[model samples]
Target: MMNKGRLYGVGVGPGDPELITLKALRLLRSCPVVAYQSADDKESIARGIVAEYLPGNQIEVQYHLPRALDPYAAQPIYDEVVIPIQEHLAAGRDVVVLCEGDPLFYGSFMYVFTRLSDHFETEVVPGVSSPMGCASALAVPLSYRNDVFSVLPAPLPAEVLEAQLLNADAAVIIKLRRHFTKVRDVLHKLGLASRARYIERGTMANQRVVSLDDMDPSQVPYFSMILVPSKSHL
Candidate 1:
């Protein structure tokens, strides 16, 4: 029997195409099969970042995993996408799964990695996470000496969000789509609203960086993030 091909989870960074690691670029170009998560409309942020690196002859696969409020609801979509990936590995054709930010950091690639790792030789190429990218874009330091930095996904309940925000010295709230108002209100109540910054499409060409005070909570994208700097450091 022929040896199975290796699977690579490549993080393409937040939004800047140049932020992609050299190793990731190499793997993307060399791999025969390239896969990325996309909407039903076939749009994928990860694919856009690595588009230049993908060779013309490479077989591109888009898994239409629609954005959802409940993460568990996407399991069925993952199951469907895994079949073709497994087939490629079985055929001894290496597959590169494109991911945004670090593959393991609140990324869809985690779902794929967990399912495929035991069955195939897998490796992860890390990239700059959105929080880090947002920090750079806003010229804010994420943490200072002895400062605790927390990362919170905005999908949690308002009470949970408030509790965590109150305890952390600094925090980043990600997935700030429809939950913008709730996150903003929580920050305001904690007296950290003025200290926070809102960043949309960080490191991208059209990136927007604004103070949380000035931002209108209603009109925010899913790619947005809120950076709450450490009070001690500030």
Candidate 2:
């Protein structure tokens, strides 16, 4: 019997290819197969990030995980998409599943990781997450000593977001594509609008930093973020 191949879930960083770690780059290039997920109609963001570095000899596999679905309803589809990666692993071909940010941090790679890690040898490489990337681009300090930090998904109810904001010293409001206006209103109501920096495609080549009021809610993209920095200063 052939030995099974090792599985790698490598975080490619928020958007910048430069942010990929040395270890991740090594594993990514050495792997016999490279994989990432995207919609049938869209190009893979993860693949685009590292397209320059690929040796062009590795077998590339692209899977599709639809945007915004009921996870329960999407489970079967998710399960189905990962079968190709599993087949490569079973054939003793090492597969590197590329993720946008940290693989386990609300990453789509989690779908593959959860499915394949149990059956094969697995490894995960950490990368720069969105909060950190956005904060750097904004040049704002996120948290001070003992300051609480919160990651609030914009999909949550306004009341719930408000309550969470009231408790944390700093926060990053994400998943704001369709919920930008709601999050903007909450920030204004909570008097955090001034401190909240709105950026779209943060750290990407076409990155845009716009004021909260200036943002066109309808034009918001999936990669946008709102960074609320801590008020405390040393």
Candidate 3:
């Protein structure tokens, strides 16, 4: 009987190629099939991060799990995207799936993990997530001693965001694309606008750190983040 292939969920880190971990690189190269999230026209960010390291002869699979949809309603969609990865594993060929950040930390790989972990051997490699990457790029401390930190997605309603901010000493605002104006207004109302720092594509070659107040709402990208660092100083 042919043994089933092992499945690996490898985190490629934020955007910098050097951010890839030794373990991730090892498995990434050893796997016969490499899978990543991709759009019809654009290369996946996860793949782009480690493009130079790819061996070039391995079979590559691209899957897209659409965003902004109801989770319950997206089950069939998630099932459909992972079919390519499952087919590779079924053939007894080890597969390495690339994730932008830590696999469990709001990663796209979750779709694959939830569906395949029960049927196949699986491993996940952690990588530097957006908040940590942005904090380093901004050269600001994320939290001080005894400080509470929170990750607030920008799509959240103003009242909900305000409440979360009220309790957090430090916060990272993510997914700011279309919700930038709403989040900006909420931060101003809570007197946190001045303390917030904005950046786009942190740790990448095109990284840009912009003052929060000066950021144009219409121009915010999916890779942008707002860091509200702890006020306490050492």
Clashes of each: 0, 0, 0
What digit string (tens of lDDT, one per residue) describes model 3 on residues 1-84? 988899999998889899989999999988999999977888899999999999999999999988878999999999988988
Between candidates 1 and 3, the one scoring higher on lDDT is 3
Taking all chains together, each candidate's TM-score versus the true structure is 0.94, 0.98, 0.98
Q: Which run of 10 residues does model 1 get worst, by summed lDDT?
A: 62-71
Q: Residue pairs in steric clash, candidate 1?
A: none
Each model's C-alpha lDDT? 0.88, 0.93, 0.92
* 94 Cα displacement, candidate 1 (Å): 0.2
Instruction: Itemize residue pairs with steric clashes in candidate 2.
Output: none
Q: Write the per-residue lDDT of candidate 2 for residues 67-87, one digit (tens) a residue.
A: 689989999998999999999
* Candidate 1 backbone overlaps, count: 0
